[model samples]
Structures are given as structure tokens and as C-alpha cells.
Target: MAEISQVSLGDAIYDRVCQDLVEGKLRPNEKVTIRGLAERLGTSSTPVRDAVQRLLRDEALIQRSMRDVRVPVLTEAQYLEIASIRRELEGFAAGRAAEMVGPKEVRRLKKIVERNEAAAVAGRWPQAVKYNQEFHFALVEAAEMPILLAILSGLWLRMGPLIAGYYAREQLGLVRHHQAIIAACENRDPAAAAAEMRADIDDAKEGIIRYIQSFTIDE
Candidate 1:
């Protein structure tokens, strides 16, 4: 029982760190020390070390030297690659969701979308990011494809920080793509849903890529 409790605690630490990463509390290329994390989390170093090791293994954090661990700063090529893959996989998931979604699920997703828009419009970027993730996951979950959902989760875990950073700097637009996706799902149009999902991803991809490129030019 004691051992189980310790494992659970370690897992909890891991989850908290992951959530921080997803929320952009931990930025790309930011240094992370086990001791620092342990102190910040108010826990022993053991679990914090274990959690850092897990994130390292997952490629969410990269080991720079013998002692330096930092969040990964994705190159433009890498970001574009991931975005292309997401366009295909996530688009497919949206299509499947459109076919399977019921009125109740549609209502739930609509509420999430509305909340996300409201948060974005109000300049509550963190809340908007949270709602955006919720909206995407809700749609994917409706597809009832566990394998696809798992893949999407992994992708989001890697991309979430970047998305949060992008949205934090930019003002919220209409998010017409999201509304289009919802409408397509309501109409039971799988192709239209998939196309809208792809467009949404493409738009974000272009914006983030441009931002990164400009930063590079400035440097």
C-alpha cells in the first residue's frame, strides 16, 4: 500500500507538470531542474525527478547537457511536420465525430465552443486555451476511436504550449472555422466537418509559423 501511494504521488506530480506545460506556464526552452521543481511543487526530490525523467522520455523535455533539462523549442520544420500530420489525423477524427455525434453531444460541444469564444473575446487567454483544448478533445472523444484519441492526445501534449503562446499574443478573431465545424457536425456532413477542421489547423499553423519566423529574423 505504501509503495502504491508513492507511485500515485509520482504520477500526480507528472500530471501537474504536464498540465503546466499544456497551459504554457512552462515555456519552450525554459530550464527545469529537479531540485527547482521539487521546491516549487512542495514535494521530495524523488517524485519530481521521476516526473522529469518521464517527460524526458516522452520528448516533451529535452536534456541539453549532463545537468540541463529544458522544454523543447520546436524548429519550423518540426512544427510544420506535426501540423501536417495533425491535419490528416485530426481532420479524420472530426469527420468521424460528425457521423457519430448526437444532439446531446452536439449541445455539449457547442457550449464549449461558446465558452472558448467568450473567453478569447474577453482577453482571458488562459481560459480560452483551456476551452479550446476541451472543445477539440470533446469532438475527438465523440468519434469513439480510442486509438485515434490516444494519438491526438499525444500530439496535443506536444503542441499545447505552442498554441497557448500563439494565442496569448494575438487578439481573438471570430473563430469562424469552429462555428463551421459545429454546423457541419449538426448537418451530419462528414466531409464538410473534416474540411473545416483542416482549415482551422492550417490557419493556426500558418500564424504560428509566421510568428516563429519573424522572431528568428529579429534574432
Candidate 2:
């Protein structure tokens, strides 16, 4: 089990909403209610409002006027745009971390990757997604660039659901992709790290597109 620190009320709300999005409990373009969110999170309306505001700023949620909100619909173009930004930002983060990643950090990342692999094999999709997120975040944090990390955080929020959906269908390939990233970091090869990161992001985009399209004909 990974050490997931308890977050503030707002962050807790945000993560729970994000998890719902990933699990398809909150579908694309579905309207969200503050009261509903508060009840679901077992928190008050204030933190739920704060969380929704933050997600709106991230463009993960659409805010209509002062009272209404909806899940941002995932369009092909929008998905591509977000995927491109993530590739550029995260690839840069991985490359930079390669420059500064020490033995301790590498060891931690390896452990996360290993745990993530095990989780995936055991069909624990949520745990796999959680570990995968921690692994990437650990690398980005190791870069030691607060501004860059902050920027990447927004991009990652948008990427979360697509990633979760992708892994819900495909597991072994995703696990292998993480292994490639771990290998690049272990070898301290920044260029390889960036290339692998981009490839992984691109693959994820394709997988998500395919997954959505498979269901579109029925809709």
C-alpha cells in the first residue's frame, strides 16, 4: 500500500471527484451539483465549492454562471491538445529529473513502478492508477521546479480519467511503459527519458480514443 497522505478538505474533494470521473461515475458533460458533491464527500459545501472552482480553473469542469457545473466533454481535438501539452511538460519534467534523480529517488520510483506492476497484474485498477500517478509525480517533484510542477499538475488532472479508462482495458502494455520510464531514469539518460515519456503519452491518447470510439456507435 502506498502512503497517500490525507489532503485538505478542498483537495480531498478534488481527488474524489477526479476518481469518480475516472471510474465513469461522472460521465462527460454530466451536470454536477454542489449539494451532491458535499454529500458525496461527507464534507460541507465550502470545500466542495473550492474544489469545483479549482477544477473549473483547470478546465476539467465547465462552470456556467455562478451555480451550475458540468464535466468537461472529452472531444477528439480537446483530448489531443491536452495530450500534447502533457507530453511536452511531463517529458521535460522527466528529463530534468534525470539530471538530478539520485539513488534514493530512483529507488523510490522503482518501488512504485514495481508495486504498480503488481497491482495491475492483480486486476486492481484503482491501485494501479494510484501507484502510477505517484511514480510520475515523484519524478516531476524530483525535478525541483515548483512552477513547472504546478503547471504540470493541471495537465495531469485532465489526463487522469483518460489514463484510468485506458488501463481498465489494457494492463500489461501500460505496466511495460512504466518499466521503460523507470529504465530511462535508472540509466540517467535524459533524451531517452523524454522520448519514452512522449511515446507513452501518445500511446495513452490513442488508447483512450479507441476506448471511447468503441462505445460511441452504441450511443
Q: Which candidate is the best by lDDT?
A: 1
Q: For candidate 2, write residues 137-212 as lDDT tens digits.
A: 7888888888987776666666666666567667644556667776787888888888888887876766688765
Model 2 CA deviation exceeding 4 Å by range: 1-31, 63-70, 214-219
Best by TM-score: 1
Worst ten-residue run, lDDT, model 2?
1-10
Error of 2 at 142 (Å): 1.5
Task: Please give the RMSD to the true structure for each candidate, in Å.
Answer: 2.4, 5.9
Error of 2 at 205 (Å): 2.5
Clashes of 1: 0
Q: TM-scores across all candidates?
A: 0.90, 0.78
